[model samples]
Target: MNKHETYAWFRVVFIGTACAWLCWRLFFADATGGADIWDRNRETMSIVSYAFVFAMAVFTRPGKGVVADERDRAISAFAAKSALVALSLVVLVSATIIGTEGHADLLTARSNGWFEHYLFACVMFGWWVESAICVFHHWRDRR
Candidate 1:
C-alpha cells in the first residue's frame, strides 16, 4: 500500500497495542497480595511498546515513486498545530485545577509526582490526537 495508508495502520496498531496492554496489566493480570503489576512494570511495558512501534515504523516502506507534496506538508503542519493547541489547553486546565483544587503553590503542583503523571498522560493523549488527525486527513484526501 501507499505510505499514508501504512502510516495510518501503524498508528492504529500502536494505539491498539497500547490500549490492550493497559487493559491486560490493569484488569487481567493477577493483582493478588496487593501486588501492583502496572506500578512495577510500567517502564518495561512502555519500553516494549515503544520498541515495537519503532520497529514497525522502521520496517515500513513507501510505494515506489511516492513522495510527499504540498498537500501532505500542509496536512502535517495543520495536524502539528492542532496537537500543540490541544496540549496547551490540557496543561492550562491541569495547572488551574491543581492550583485551585489542591490549594497548593504553582511550584508544588509542577513538582508533584501526581502532576507529572497527569502531564505524561496528557502528552500521550496529545500524540494520539496528532496521529488521529493526520490519519483522518490522509483518509479524507484519499476519498
Candidate 2:
C-alpha cells in the first residue's frame, strides 16, 4: 500500500486501540477500586492519543496529490457523517436517561453514578462509531 493507506491504517489502529482502552477503563475502573493504575491508564491513553493525532497532523496528506485523493476524502466524509449521527444518538440517549431521574440532587445522589463514566462512555462510543463508519467506508469502497 501507499503512504496514504499506511497512514490511514495506522490512524485507525491507534484510535481503535485507544477506544478499546477507554472501554476497558470504563468497565474496570471499579474493579481496580480506582487505584493508581486507573490514573496511569487514563494518562497514558491520553498521551498516546494526542501523540498519534499530532503525528497525523504533521505527516498526513503531505503532497500535492489532491491533499486527500477521492477515496480518502470519501471515506473520511462518510465516517464523519456516521459519527455525527451516532453522536447525536448517544447525546439523545444520555439526555433521556439523565432526564428520567429529573436531576433531583444530581451531583450528590448515589443513584447518579459517576459522571466520568458517562463522559468516557460517550467519547469511546463516538470513536467506536467512527471506526465502524470508516470500516464500512473501506468495505464499500473496496467493493
Give TM per candidate. Answer: 0.65, 0.65
Model 2 CA lDDT for position 99: 74
Model 1, 20-100: lDDT tens digits are 555454335554223243345557756865786676567654445656778877877888898899889988986787667
lDDT of 2: 0.63
Stretches of candidate 1 exceeding 4 Å from the true structure = 16-38, 56-65, 102-116
Cand. 1 Cα-lDDT: 0.63
Local error of candidate 1 at residue 31 (angstroms)? 9.8
lDDT per residue as tens, model 2, 1-143: 54555555665676677667666755554553444455555566567667766777787746545466778778778777887788889889878866765654543432223345447557766766776666656656667
Candidate 2: segments with Cα more than 4 A from true spot: 2-4, 32-42, 64-66, 102-121
